[model samples]
Target: MTASLELPDRLAAYLQRSGVALAVSVCEGDAPLMFVNDAFTKLTGYTEDEVKGRNCRFLQGEGTSEEQRQPLHDFVHGLGEDSGRFPILNYRKDGSEFLNYVFMSRIRDSSDAVRYIIASQFDMTNAMQRSKIRQNDETLRTVLSDVEQMGREYGLAMMSSAQQLADSVAMMARLSLRDTR
Candidate 1:
């Protein structure tokens, strides 16, 4: 795809001001670099002229797995005709791999044909690692709490109706006592 129209000043300014990096491509058989912001240039270590008219696949390396490539292929080939997410693990020109969550969309004209593809990328490697650690901690805490609750109610009939379960643990203890009596 080729963009016959120019990027609006407002949208261009917005992309520039946005802290995160972004790159836009116009799919011409293969995805071609149309525009990239300064942040994107800084992140990828590629100059604007060096990337213009080049395919973004240059970022892929041996470390890049098929799991990442397949989804990207599906998005660009199928949903790229519409608008889809192109999240993938991509490498920078510097050979540094990063988790890039990219959302790809098409720019249309009066004829409703794809004119351009705008891909916004978010570097999520750090945030995703942090989230995994937090999730593990949360899971451990939940498991420990469940274990403790089981210890306190050992060999007891913990199962109950929804109304009974909604009651406090103290009320449940009273019910248990009455049952034993």
Candidate 2:
């Protein structure tokens, strides 16, 4: 086999053997699926044939906001040379949403002409979930601390005000009682 085929073949074989879920695409004029192993199909429920000639954007749906689309467009256009990463939430064919961390770069031939745009996607839903949990925990901790501090300050203010009121009442009662006696 030619080296071009051999390397990608070996890499695809290794990835399949390792059971890593990933999807790879190459884009020249239009994005095309160059290789997708069993894991990719298993993750997205799309057969290799179904995705071969399609742009990856079809995975997006009405739920996909412009906010998610603009950055990828900017990255692909801004870099010009061809390499960048953007994280996006995308839906599977079954409409299940997952966080995808996508890395894209251009592969150049010997003459350094712009050849292929290679993209690799990693499923980051679990990592993002963990990060969200940690952020929430930190936010809760800060709020609790603020509440505790406010409680202490409020308690001290109430005590000081009560003490002054009690002392004034006691003095008035003593003067009035003494004057009456």
lDDT of candidates 1 onward, in order: 0.58, 0.52
Q: Which candidate is the best by lDDT?
A: 1
Clashes of 1: 1
lDDT of 1: 0.58
Error of 2 at 48 (Å): 0.7
Model 1's TM-score against the true structure: 0.62
Across 1-181, the per-residue lDDT of candidate 2 in tens digits comes to 1234222443345434424343444434455565666767776778888886676787777777788888776654435435566678888879898887665655444444443444545566775488865753464354334334434543432122212322222222222223333
For each of the candidates, the C-alpha root-mean-square deviation to the true structure, in angstroms, is 19.5, 26.9
Off by over 4 Å in 2: 1-8, 11-18, 75-81, 128-181
TM-score per prediction, in order, is 0.62, 0.57
Q: Residue 102: error of model 1 in Å?
A: 1.2
